[model samples]
Target: MHNVHVITHPLVQHKLTLMRRKDASTNSFRRLLGELSTLMAYEVTRDMPLQDIEIETPLETMTAKVIDGKKLVLVSILRAGNGFLDGMLNVVPGARVGHIGLYRDPQTLQPVEYYFKMPSGMHERDVIVVDPMLATGNSAAAAVQRIRDMRPRSLKFVCLLAAPEGIATMQQAHPEVPIYTAAIDRELDAHGYILPGLGDAGDRIFGTK
Candidate 1:
């Protein structure tokens, strides 16, 4: 919805299409995901603040605008979230990284956090929580709440695919945090998986399935 940003970039959609095919090899799928994340990073970081600083070029001195790389943090919701790290890091090599590990209880489909770690000075660092799928939204919501506890300068959620149910759940839980996704799929399946999703993102990325 209003809080969600669906990236329609041609390269993003093209790679996403390739990834959705059932026959795509694990290697191909993983590679495409990395490439897609790199492209998506552009949109997600579009509004990052920049400051002007003086720099000397070979021929002249000039004022250049640049972001505070040290003040940007990428928080990955473990496993599948890890898949997003490499690509995003490729673009923001100086950005700090954090992790939040959560697993869904099969029966309840609720998130249970088993690990959480973040860089110091969260209150002054902008954070982007990366997870490949926003399916049930429980894990993401829980992770965001934990980050909120630290009072980060700003917070956002990023995923390759999102289900409408998940988006609604997040909106209800934390309307202040915006969500960025390549696609908002139709809905979640009976088992809480996003329909038309590229299967379990962790499995696909790690060749676990």
Candidate 2:
């Protein structure tokens, strides 16, 4: 889809490959996730609007560019999404951070929202929803719908990896929001895991398993 962007930067690819290894240590996995998130953040924010203003550099006055409109609202889809939040905040330190906690039922496979809290005046801000893996897309899509109900001026999705099924599901449900991901792997396994994905992102990121 035109709105979906797959970051192909060499550094991102290199780090992603390292993260896929079964023997990768927890420390290494966390480090790579941070590094990869930094790269992915760059691509995700490439189209942010800019405004020109006159500025005095010590030597002379010059027109400078700064981000336009309201500061961004970084919404992390809890647990796994936190892994990407650190790097994104590194790039946008002044951004407001929010959290949405949701889980998919094992049998029904439907998303159930347990928590959601956003900054005041979120409707006036640009929202970026972050998660590490987009598998069934149910969670991401549901999360977006929840955020959309808040009426942000703009919305976007960012993840480290994605499955084709997930991407399609997201497009079908929320095509207006673009998805920025590091890689689009083969397909989803029977259990809904992305093929070649770095296992459960939450486990890999937090060293729980």
Candidate 3:
């Protein structure tokens, strides 16, 4: 609850409903995810700092405003994170891409990192970490902890669906980082999945199930 940004746009909500249906095909789910993430990305970066500089217009010279630096670093948290990454990239095509692979231990539900790679100059760029669902918040928390170690200029967390339990966990562990999510569901189920959620986002996106 520290800094949760729940998108309430009609388009975002409508697409999310389609994704929640149990019968949504993998292709449809993936496509809708892309569209929804784009809308969420717009809200996430809406307050981006802008700077004015001299510019040449067709008629005459003038000052124009552009995002400060306009360089962003996007980190994907393994499989499900990839779903949001693509859409965000459409918003900032010049952003640098990073990937972190973390798997959860079934019993403890703790995250174990298997891979980590990022662009250089993380310290100079604003970073946004994407994960489709914030379930128990284990992997998302661990991923944020790792990224914080890099000491980026700023950091934001984005996810498609979030559970209250997951949001509480993130607020406890990384209260400094704000969260941008499409919806905050009621609770986390026994297996750490968000109730009334779109099910396994990775599986639905990749047609693994």
Candidate 4:
């Protein structure tokens, strides 16, 4: 847990519990994820640098703090990661967006990237990569390495859930990048799914199954 931060707010826990229910409707699950991501966004961006600027208020002129420079970027790790975009965007409306598409090979349980796209000047911008689950860590680590190549000012990984195996994989691969998650579940099953998790996030969010 050296570089990991878990959000334990009561509301976050409550919403997560609702999302885990087996009978939760796709619409309800997606809505809960959106709400939960909005809440989690507050914590992930807590350390954003701020600068003081003088502004005239209706009552008086005073210096106020605002985030420095351009807003941060939210990089979605393909299909499931997109589920976190709206909620995070709700809180940081000015944030730029990027996408990386990777699918787990059923036989090998490894990530194979099919697409990668990002904004310009990544070296000048902070980045937060979003994914619903970090079950295997291969995709997350791969995505992080690709982003690091762009040399962003700073970087963080945000996920709805994580597993101990996946966490260890990330720790070994990219120990410097901090990870933010709502929960770290028990462990991953043989097929690389979080135990007691909400099931396939992409399937749940998109009704693909």
Off by over 4 Å in 2: 68-70
Per-residue accuracy of model 4 over 46-132 as CA lDDT, tens digit each? 999888999999999999999843559999999999999999998888899999999999999989999999999999999999999
lDDT of 2 by residue, 123-200 (tens): 788999999999999999999999999999899999999999999999999988999988999998888889988898
* Per-prediction TM-score to the true structure, in the order listed: 0.98, 0.95, 0.97, 0.98
lDDT digits (tens) for residues 1-209 of candidate 3: 66998999999999999999998999999999999999998999998778889988889999989875346889999988998888998988888899999998989999999999999988988999999999999899999999999999999999999999899899999999999998999998889889988899999999999
Model 1 Cα shift for residue 193 (angstroms): 0.8
lDDT of 3 at 46: 90
Which stretches in model 4 have alpha-carbon errors above 4 Å?
A: none
Q: Pick the candidate with the highest TM-score.
A: 1
**Model 1: which ten-residue window has the lowest total lDDT?**
83-92
Model 1 clash count equals: 0
lDDT of each: 0.94, 0.90, 0.92, 0.94
| lDDT (10s digit) by residue, model 1, range 1-209 | 68889999999999999999989988999999999999999999999999999999999999999999899999999989988998998888999999999999999999999999899999999999999999989989999999999999999999999999999889999998999999999999899999988899999898988
What pairs collide in candidate 2?
none
Order of the predicted models by TM-score, top scorer first: 1, 4, 3, 2
Better of 2 and 3 by lDDT: 3
